[model samples]
Target chain A: MGLNLEFMLSIIPELLSAMVITLQISILAVLLGIMGGLVVGSFRVIGPKWLKMLIQLLVDYIRGTPQIVHILIIYFALPRIGIILNAYWTGVVALTIIATGYEVEIVRTAIESIDKGQIEAGLAIGLLKRQILIFVLLPQAIRRIIPPLTNELTNIVKASAFLSVIAVNELTKISNKIIYETFYFFEVLILTALIYTVIITLLGMLSNFIEKRMFSTNSEANS
Target chain B: MDISFMIEIVPRLLRATWVTLQVSAISLMIGLVFGIVLGVLRVYGNRFIVWCTKGFVIVARGTPAAIQIYAAFFLLPRLGIRLPLFAVGVVALTFNTSGYQVEIVRAALESIDKGQIEAGLAIGLTRWKTMLYITLPQAVKRMMGPMTNEFANLIKASSALMLISLYELTKSGHAIIAATFKYAEVLVLVALFYFVLVQSLCKLSAYLENNVFNFGKTADPRNEFLN
Candidate 1:
């Protein structure tokens, strides 16, 4: 009934293995999100009128709902609509959709942050729209955007824990399995949480370091 | 997309929306109180309390809210800590939201100039008095904008309460879908409940951001989407 060291030791091995699935889903989701966000965000920022409106509407719809709702909808609702996604695809697709909403905002803001004069200079130098974006705006925006984008990546990692409810055998669900078997509820949950804390905090520290370095370099280059 | 089904489910969902808000509202008030305390402690308490509060935030931020909900709902009964469903929802959500709100408040407090406190002491104010009178009011005003954003997030997050068999808005939609087999229609309408709630929250956040910064000075538009 009390904290069992023996049970804790036994369950850790299982939890660590389950953590692989958690990382697998989160990393995959984030990668897909970045790619999707780059394309969609770029288009939304500078694309034609109708496409911008369409993506804007889609982003609003995605933004309004919670991540848990998205996972539930993807897993349950899609099958009825004659689309079947396996657990892996479901995790990737759903989390990517949510990630893209935030990532697009990050990218849009990053692009918008570039001074308008830089764009004018690029145009004056005979650069095309794409060349101006790629050559003039993106380099600066990438440095500024790293912190928020990393923050979103941490969000995806946390969101992976929700995938347990859909029986994804991620870290949280694996802990639930251990809890039922060992009745070490408190020990198991704490241990599971510690792993996530370590991962997310490391990412946060990395983002802070990047932001600080970028800030100093930007200031230096300006001077 | 199944308008008749939506019409039929609307009333039931609306009723559950109140239940959901009750959970969020109660938890948010409790969480805000806890947040204010923890926020101050993190900023000005002795090293131990500050460190302990960091541990609390670490746990809250690291795991999913569902895990907290599960521990509160399922494991506690086994631990001889029995609570009603509503109480459990409030406890779990409040615990989780406090972890976040404390960060918001602490950041607000940190942004204040340290020289102001030194100035207060020069004017014969005690350290506690300096904090209470000189620091907290400004922090709370700036806190309101981010606080509203967190409150809106809290409401949206309350949807996770569905897992523990509580009929909050998200769960209410599931109940309707389970009975009527109108999954798409019920979910669409359910999404509408959330959309309207979040949009209103954004408006409130914008209002607070504009009107609450400084001694009624406007916030910088460059940082408008910041939080």
Candidate 2:
């Protein structure tokens, strides 16, 4: 089949509109995931024994299962418990749940990587556990976590494609819609991939820049 | 809410577990074969082949597997190449895993010391013979841990099969949930199945770490830097 430049150009605007929804879902999910990760990560490390085990189990389950299945469970199953969310919210919630699981491990590892002496120093200074966690542990942990956290964000962006399965009108879903309408499957898919590649590439570059800056600064301070 | 309904669904889900295992096992085997070949090619092949292999790895690694499955399911049929849902899932996953596994296997091969290859050559072995006899055996040993992790990853990733309408474990759980509307209960069970599978793999990794990959015991200075 001959390429339809005009048709493709016209669909660009619709696809661009859908990109907004995709970005919105990714960004919101990442934010919720990061927040959830902090809570769960801290709980896993420093919370009560039972809570730590529960959070650890949650993280394992999330990491072990596929995002699509998690989405299906959240979207379809939640309604049985009287929690009826729209597709977009369902997508975000489910993605957040999965993301949080992975992110907790990232955060917990970051926290663990912080020098134990620093925590001891905080205790030596008469800082309470809460103060030490809030001021000292979190800052260092967050700094160490920037790289992995960025990676998790990129993963969430790619994973947001699963939202399309539930008809959330994200970029991939929109591309599917266009393909269904125009019957230009290759063009639509290639275009969709290009969009994703561009966005993810930019995010990757930005994260690398930040990682270098942080590490170099840290090294300079240490030296 | 109904325990009896979940109990009724268990037999069906257990039967569907066979499909999940089949897809994971077949895809893992195919992916490992392709991964090792591509990985070795990337290391030992000429420049053009290396570039082509790199390109394959990059594209496969860069995109989501779900999109790959969707593309395969929808696009291949347009070219009069119709693959069954299970075939599509396995092929998509094999392609996906090959990309990542190429890097893993390549890294393991590269980690082997150069002197071993030269020693084999000194013994009058041809390059290919030396590679097969000297390099691969050591590389395979080094790859044991990573390969185990990759197998676990394959099991987890096979959950993507559900998106393509393959009635794997996750899909089976969704099927049960559809009838019983016990989303939380069914998902928890599904999650437990995944946990048991992955945790067993993790235990296997730990065992390999302790018993086989004895670098842990040596306290080699490399461990300090690596840790």
Candidate 3:
């Protein structure tokens, strides 16, 4: 009851295996979210007027609501429409949707952050619009977006814990399981939080390092 | 998808929405006060205090908001302290909000021109007076946009209080879902309620950034982390 350091250490292996699930889901969501964000983000920028409005509404809905509500809706509502997914996939879908929402904005903002002259310069060089986006705009935009994209990545990792609400065997859910069995809420939850903090802190450091490197080289190129 | 059931549940959901607003409003106010202190400390406090502030922000932002709420709800009672469910919700949320708010304040304060602070000191103003008169006025204007986004983020996050069995809007939706087995309609309505609340905050943020705080300059769209 005082502090179960021994028990906390004992459960770490279990928690770590669950952490793998967390990593898997996060990595998967990041990939899909980035891809979806790139497509949807580009469409919002270059697509026709009506499609832009549609995508904007979708983005706003995803941004406005909570991730927990998203998971719950995907869990409960999908079956009514004949689209049944398990807890894990439901989590992926929800996290991806959330990530893509913010990522679209990141992408759009990053793309827009590039000066208008860059696009015109590409046109003057005889590059097609698609070619300009890929060979010209995106390479530059990727550098600018690294910070926000990394922030979104960390958010997806943290948000993965919400999947526990739907009985996914992730870190938080496993910690909840241990707490129920042993009532070591303090030790277990603290350790669980440490795992997340350590991961995210490292991520933050990495983002800073990358941003520094990218900008320094960018300035060097400018010079 | 029972239209009638969804319509009927609106009043019940609205009552719960009131709880959500109460919880978030209390937490946001508390968070703003603490956030300003911590933000200033991170900028101007001693080494120890700055390290402590950084550590707190990392932990608060790093962990899932739900876990923080769970710690308050589940761990406190284990430690032989008792509080009402509403207090727990607000305490957990304020902790979460203050974490992000610290970064916002820190950024805004850091953005103030160092020359102006020195200029104030050169003209015989004390450090606190310089900060109070010169730095804070400018920082407050910059803080408004990010702070509004944080408020919306807090409101959306308050929905996590349902995990602790706090009877807020989400719990209200769950109740209706259980009784009627109309998951889609009820949950959609629930999401819509949250959407409306958060969107209004978003609109207010835009208005402040563009009209109130613009000063004829194009607004910067850099604050994406909160959304």
DockQ, in order, for the candidates?
A: 0.50, 0.41, 0.58
Question: What clash count goes with each model?
Answer: 0, 0, 0
CA-only RMSD, every prediction: 2.9, 3.8, 3.1
Query: What is the per-residue lDDT of model 1 for residues A1-223, given as tens digits with 9 covering 90 to 100?
Result: 6677877787788889998888888888887888888889877777777877788778877887777778878877778778888887888888998989888878887888777778788888998888887787778777767788888888888888778767888888888888888667888887887888888889889889988888887883232
Which lDDT tens digits does candidate 2 get at residues B150-193?
A: 88888877877777779999888877767766787787778767
Residue range A169-202, candidate 2, lDDT tens digits = 8998888888888788878877787787777777
Worst 10-residue lDDT window, candidate 3 chain B: B218-227
Highest lDDT: give the candidate number.
3
**Of 1 and 3, which scores higher on DockQ?**
3
Clashing pairs in 2: none
- Ranking the candidates on TM-score from highest down gives 3, 1, 2
Worst 10 residues of 2 chain B by lDDT: B218-227
- Candidate 1: tens digits of C-alpha lDDT, residues B115-190: 9899999999998899999999978887888888887888878888887889899988888878877677877888
Worst 10 residues of 3 chain A by lDDT: A214-223
* DockQ, cand. 1: 0.50
Q: TM-scores of all models?
A: 0.93, 0.88, 0.95
